[model samples]
Target: MSNRAPLSNKEIKTRFEAALMGNYGLPAVPIASGSGVRVTDADGNVYLDMIGGIAVSTVGHGHPRYVEAIADQAAALAHTSNLYLHRGEVELAEKLLELVEARGKVFLCNSGTEANEAAVKLVLKAGKPYGRTKIVATENSFHGRSLGALAITGKAAIREPFAPFGVEAEFVPYGDARALAAAVDASTAAVFLEPTQGESGVHPATTDYLKAARRITSENGAALVLDEIQSGFGRTGAWFAHHAAAITPDVVTLAKGLAGGVPIGATIGVGKWGDVFGPGDHGSTFGGNPIACAAALAVIGVVEDEGLFENVLALGERLEANLADHPAVTEVRGKALWRGIGLAGADSAAVCDALAARGVLANPVRPDTIRIAPPLTITAEDVDLFCDILKDVLSTAPEGPNHE
Candidate 1:
């Protein structure tokens, strides 16, 4: 609306390097605008968005209903601190509980890390009365960047630098029932786990593993906290990835796709744990903003109305069948669109760059793994196009340095 001119990709990168922190590195692609599942970069190149803003764009980019809901909410009312209640927040919380199918309370926050922090407090407080202090998490599990969430995250590189996180945490091999059982004991206050590990490549836990975790934590009087930041909100073709296990965790932290890319996070405490957080224990100023809640409501409505779950299942089946049999792919892991493609011999990072150059966007979650978490709104044709592009890229990709 002003006299400012749009910056080109080079200019954007220059400014980014000059002003921003190097934590993420300068973005390879400077996206200018997006429509549906496609994004146009500052260089005027169009790309099929497979990453979905790292699995945050639930309803796809610029969805009509989602846009309208956000606009309407913003125009009507925006921020009202935690001092007074609003309909959007209350309705969103109620809807979350209903979808979770649990009788509990919802603590709204701004990000997955904050949600986990609230959960950490709840579990620690619950255990304080009984002298329980330890927390058990899974190896390679990614919760968030916050110190509290980082303390429970089992990855060494990111969590180690900030020593003395104040939270006593233990790590166990993911999906190992015996290891988990061995790690959790009377002194354990909580067990934090992801239904599907997304960052270190999307690896889903078996039903037996999750059920065993539930049993073990319950027996040890430890709160079973499921971090569904990336795996929840229909990413696994279910409302929650943990639903497949048929076990209700005491605490579930949700974010990412919760608000169709709008910043929102939720911590649901099931049963008695919901009442654990009393006055002044925890809160967020912009946690339950009406705009984000409205966006979330719209996303949920669109997902149900359009039957995206069935679409996700159908596309998942199609994608797995195609990718798993590809000559360049060794294996495909994960559920629905949240897939991690194991490259047979190609370097995943190089392959992703090639894919991007050819107009498809994906994530190299590991050196040999390509993770795709496309939006649910994409059509069958979109999947076919992605498959074709990926096939072309991988076919021409060079062998990785580690290739035998």
Candidate 2:
């Protein structure tokens, strides 16, 4: 390593702002190093990581086993495109199918958006024979920013500027079976819904709503697509949040936590829907790269061997229980490790900043909602510390929104 002083946090942010696009604006902190469930900033201050790279760091930062897998795979083989067959890519696909407890075909990509884009193709093909082209999504639901996925994404603000989305879609109110049943019909190619709305404050769908969607899609010759990109890979104390719904979906999208911070996405098509795509339908040059597949395999192995799913359940319960009595908290949304806090009257931005000042990292997902999706490998001490710091921040949380 070079024996030179590192850049300060402010300097790093300045360079990033100057060089990078303004899409994300300025970062809150410049993280230098991380391990397990903690990260140290460029300023040498350490923090308990509750955001977990927006739920992407599943096995936590710098996990020895995960590191070894990626290193070993890279040393042996890394990129092979889709032309040549590789062990990791094939194995990862099988593992994903097994995790979903379904017999299917897998399409690998590099992010949640890509996976959703593949899903759009899968549903389109499935419905093409019936002369269907429209997809059904829900209000306040976020699919991705890609043209195809954005069409199914129900957020009007983001979809407005990018008008004329690739695929046409119908938007229904989330958790409303009547609206969903009414919106979906023979002309509908597929019904896409999140098991739990992640970007929209971590809202979960009701049992009846999901059941209705399954029934409606089945009857209408439309595929039921579950967007589990945020809720899959044990984030919600289950292999996939839809598993708890006791219903099998025709298509499912996965990413975010799949490779534990390594970019990887998957679209799993169950039964007949798996055979939708023939050659030349779609392709990704770097999709299912050996290194990413190896990392995903390592993550699944670690989650199973260490029982991270159960840990998530326990940790989630503890968090919800601990924060329930806080004066500033009104309600907690989501399940397992994927949680969102609804502030009583305090502003979420202030609470997030306050928590950051107190050595904990979280995301203010909405004006009144704070999101927490820590590494599943966090220890009891980590949870306790986060709870204590969160409570303290809430006690002194700013009253109103002050983005300035």
Candidate 3:
């Protein structure tokens, strides 16, 4: 008998397209299960996932502690609306504050977009009564795809069609301190930016720039909001990427890896920003789902008790060092497990397909940029294998991604 399962990729795709929306079109394979950094397809082919669910799987797939936390939480008590409070929700919020080493208030939500939306609402509502209206964001920065987040998102192709974005926001060059300062004024409610630009190819914000934003926002009484959805939670060497800048922002949005793949997001407000919202301001139905909170708590515990931060630093150093010297790679940006690769003469899409063919999974975040956000728990051997496969894909290619 054959080792491969009876199911085929075409069969799965057909059924999936029939029942699901057209947004994702069709995935490469139907994943049945995953362990550590690898996933097994329905047809039983195993592939190493380097994207880590786009940076959502912090502790890797099917981590024992993460699994137990969700299972235990569900087995006990599951969903409770915001009208009612739960231990998991409270504890998760407290843990978030502790991890950042800042005094803040937290409102949990379902995803990264939702967290950005909530943060926007907090800013808009707070500023409305105070005569502040405009929000400042940087070019090439991606907050989320939701309406409000889309408004603040700096990508024109995605946001233009969805124009009349409802929110008043100004876009400036990402790293230019002067351009950013000029864009903000007394009427500006907030300045939203990513500590490291992930969607526009993993560009890191300079520490001086972060400090300037912090200083300008403080001087002008506008909120400085750092979108850490991708760079937070040990994805970077530190617990949070902004910690490297050694500056604090007014409001910080978090998601993606918060619950180690569980769907959860959080909007954290520091000091006065924390008190911006009052009763009946905002809420979420399945935001702080007990299972999600339990999962987040477990991820945090494991990250701390097991000293994953130190590992992230070491592994990040290794990944950057190994990939930077590649001839085809023009630049390596971002920190730790989250990185963006600038391809010299390869179609990132074709490279991704080639990687998939070679039993590795990654994403073409941009046409010329390949993003690798593997699980934090991935071993040194995994990094070596990924780099080796990528080098092979580049060398053996007949032409760029558009050709063979």
Which model scores highest in lDDT?
Answer: 1
> Candidate 3 vs. truth: CA RMSD?
2.8
Q: What is the TM-score of each candidate against the true structure?
A: 0.98, 0.97, 0.96
Candidate maximizing TM-score:
1
Scored by CA lDDT, what does every candidate get? Answer: 0.92, 0.90, 0.90
Residue-wise C-alpha lDDT for candidate 2, range 1-404, written one tens digit per residue: 67887999999998998899999989898999998999999999999999999999999999999999999999999899988879889899998889899998999999999999999988887778788999989999999999999988988999889989768889999999988888887789999999999999999987777888899988988899999999998889998988887999999999999999999999999988889999999899989999999999999999999988888899888888888778777788898889988887788888888888889999999998999998999987788888898888888777866323
RMSD of 1: 1.1
Error of 2 at 379 (Å): 1.6
* lDDT ranking, high to low: 1, 2, 3
Position 254, candidate 1: lDDT: 95
Report the Cα lDDT for candidate 3: 0.90
- The number of clashing residue pairs in model 1 is 0
lDDT tens digits by residue: candidate 1, 121-151: 9999999889899999999999988999999
Off by over 4 Å in 3: 1-7, 401-404
